[model samples]
Target: MTYFPKLLTICILACILGATTFFYVKKSVYIFDTNYFKINSVSRAALKETGSKQCKNCSEGVPNLIIQYGVGRTATTLQFQILCLMMAFLHEDEINDVGCYYNRRNLVKKYNVIKCHDISWYLTVKWSKWVFMTSNHALLSRRLNYMRGKIKDKNTTIPFIADIDLVSRRGHYIVHEYQRFFGISDEKMQHIVEYLRYWDVLRVCCGMQMSADWRNHLAPKAKYKQHHSYHSPTYPACEMYNISQVEHLLVNTYVFKKLSHIGSLRDVIGKTSTVDGILNGSYCERCNTNISKMHLKFNQNCA
Candidate 1:
């Protein structure tokens, strides 16, 4: 009777352990499968989009829309957070002022009031370092000059000007250093630079130049409509350039060669498509095109 009890206890303990292990493993597998499936759907969509040559004007050739960076006076963190959130919600091609905060009323009234998160590590690290480094002003100036020089080489029609604030002592130093490094001595150019500097300082110190201000400056009030659909705009369309013009620019300009490094929405689509295919055994039309012969050809010769 004692041995019987012991055996019963052992059997019960084994059953419990086995049940626990099975449940744990099952949950983990389910989670993994869910994520895998989502990724596959996104991937397939991207591949299909790439293959279909749909939105060809935006895809194959187009200049990135003009991106305006806004610097606010107060609520720096909030502004950064909002900008990142907007990036997440909005299409990459949509040209709007980022890196600044807007009045809640103004956001609702004047622009599309979409919720965005902070996604500006580039500004936080790269731009902020150049702005804040007191001792490395000269180095910063040299770097800005080099960047401008490269821009000049790429597009002679576009005027290359480094805008810095004149009101703040730090801003003045940055402008002086930049001018010295770049050998920019033209009186008109200097004045324009000074004006840009004034605007930036006013933006940061006075809180006058917020996102709303930028919206008024760049886009028409009527054009600021909220989009309910999930379509993300491409660079050319977002920039408001004619599709043909964007295509020509993309063909001529070699600047965006680095886009291949950063994984885009296409990657997401591809993953989603693959997962869906595996699970359903049904080929999605979009996913099919992505893996099609024509798509393979484009992928090989995307350059």
Candidate 2:
């Protein structure tokens, strides 16, 4: 009997709470044939938080497994970037510990850290560390509505939601439990921030058609409307709710405030799909520079 069908059923239920945040343990594994996960006896690894300098050499034993799980619109992409940066500080061989290099789009590795929006996690007897990302319910709903272009006005709200209490508890966990878990030093943090800043800038450039090459490179198969970077101007225009509370809490916890410094609704509204369109935006040299740098970092030959 294949578990594929059952696994899909489990995925829908697990999507709500499992991916958002939770750790479970049980003595035995039994297919209850229900939504609940009957976690197996997997040894949860106790990792000692080490700074970037201390990670100069890889440990002798099996490298600790790190997994970051979250629902959509909870900054999963941003967290993925942060986790990748964290993975890079490890010894050269361990640097490829992540399952795949996003920039290179390669998967020749046994991933040390796994990021999943889907609650498809399974228990392995091997040691593992889990990081569950959560977001405020209001903020999450707003993001969802925006991404789907469902906004009508300030009163407009999305039916889907994030758990409020989980968001608060996770915020506290970030403060107390694993502040240095990623082992990012000050210098590394600065670089990560700069990288994030440039990343968003390039995103804005692509959205505004300031860099056609980047848009083509990033979303070759996607149409302008279907592009991952696509944003509806109505959502932003109608967004009167202040998600600043969540942003503030996240910034205090993870120092991820640079995200707000990126492009705005005007950029999205200004996008043009035509080659001959007289766009007000000009090509960004910095965007091209970062694109080349990224290509080089991923061992891709720059054009």
Model 1, span 1-303: residue lDDT tens: 699999999999999999999999999999999987765444343234322243233212211121122232222222222222223223334323322222211222111221112223222221111111111223223443343344334432111122222222243233443232223345633443433332232222111122332222233355555422225321112223232333333223221221112232111111111112211112222222333323322112211
Error of 2 at 263 (Å): 30
After superposition, the stretches of candidate 2 with alpha carbons farther than 4 Å from their true spots are 1-63, 97-111, 138-179, 203-303
Cα-based lDDT for every prediction: 0.29, 0.35
lDDT of 2 by residue, 159-258 (tens): 1122334323342122222225544455656545544443433333332333343444543434534323335321121122222232223334222332
Question: How good is model 2 by TM-score?
Answer: 0.34
* Candidate 1 residue runs with Cα over 4 Å from true position: 53-303
Give, for candidate 2, the lowest lDDT window spanning 10 residues: 39-48
Error of 1 at 152 (Å): 30
Error of 2 at 76 (Å): 0.8
TM-score against truth, every candidate: 0.19, 0.34
